[model samples]
Target: MTSSDLWDAETAERYDESSAFMFAPDVLDPAVDFLADLAGDGAALELAIGTGRVAIPLAARGVAVIGIELSQPMADQLRRKRSDIPVVVGDMASTAVPGTFSLVYLVWNGLGNLRTQSEQVACFRNAARHLAPGGRFVIELWVPGIRRFPPGQEAVPFHVGAHHVGFDTYDMTTQQGTSHHYRRHPDGSVTYGASNFRYVWPAECDLMAQLAGLELERRVADWTGEPFTTDSESHVSVWRRPEPPSRPLEAPAGA
Candidate 1:
């Protein structure tokens, strides 16, 4: 993971407030429900957990949840909410926590934060490493929106609101993109923020999972389980680690 991608103290401090819409019941509840159902009496691990936005509610539902976050400030913000959830501070691609889990998840396009194909692949392997046999690894990611780009256009606007304007600029050759945000304050001052990520295709993610010894289980347009059609803008995909092969029965008393 790139250290430059880490959310700093300022970003962490304003994270929840800046992205408040994501915490609404309409957006958050379905995600918690989906993950809790997958966990099903087993522990769940979150990659790039970031401020406990999902982990807090998911944990409230009686599912054991642990987290790995690359940003210490983000982890600190999460700790402020609830002290019980264990959050390891390190890169999600290679961080190792003790014990295995029934479910491992990376939500809100966190995989893109890795910024490199190899790092993203390593993240899949890391998720597989922390899963118990037959455990599931899940990711929620945006489908690259290059189709909206006309000739010679490298940027597309995603949000144009009363107080904020946001756009993403893509580099087709490198599969990298940067999301730029301009927020207008009550005083008419504007603040600018940007984050960089490498966009990945759904097929590429499946190949990474395969390389990590996991099998594709399902893919949906969102946490609500909408069927993933060609026009879907984002996806929530699941891949499961195969259970260990059973040993052959031994002859009774070595007869």
Candidate 2:
């Protein structure tokens, strides 16, 4: 299993084109709108800001945004569209980007890019470090349905389309999954790519955030603030850094 840096030059180059649907106005508007509202004129730092799919539009909405990306090629792709927003090239799990932000967000399954529990915990810590008092850290990820991987069956198909196909292979013991993608081209060619990630339960995520000094603020099924339900396939969770520690009470006579 690879780390967040798994998006290599080849994967990065094709990323925008391959996942173009995610950028459509209908699909992207809600996400950008949600984050922009949370930012409320304050700065936002995006972890694993791949190709600026969300950051670009969010910045356009008047939120000053910065990004941290491990894949230089992916960051390079975003550089073409906007350069004003700074992007730190480093691991999202431990790398420290400059400045405190009102909001830090990890979206599009990026949090899962960390393939181990320790690494995932580090990512939560990193987010807490970037947040100011009363700031928020948001994450969007799918709830693990890995229990469906009964017996020897390991692969589960999630997407099948005219041009693209995708599946996830679960390792029950390790709680790791390898997401595989394949796209077909007009010239009768196909390209396959895969990345490793650790699937996380919502409760586990909350505990990790707590360990990093964040508290769950809200959770929704999508960017529109819909209530999270057991039937929900994915969730957008918001966690907030509490205010700085208050002064302890002193006894009347200095007891």
Tens-digit lDDT track of model 2 for 38-125? 9997999999998999999899888999999988888998998898878998889888988899999999888898888999999999
- Compared with the true structure, all predictions reach lDDT values of 0.95, 0.89
Highest-scoring model, TM-score: 1
TM-scores of the models, in the order given: 0.97, 0.93
* Model 2 lDDT, residue 83, Cα: 82
Which 10 residues in a row give candidate 2 its minimum summed lDDT?
1-10
Residue pairs whose backbone atoms clash in candidate 1: none
Off by over 4 Å in 2: 150-152, 245-255
Residue range 20-93, candidate 1, lDDT tens digits: 88899999999999999999999999999999999999999999999999999999999999999999999999
Off by over 4 Å in 1: 1-4, 253-255
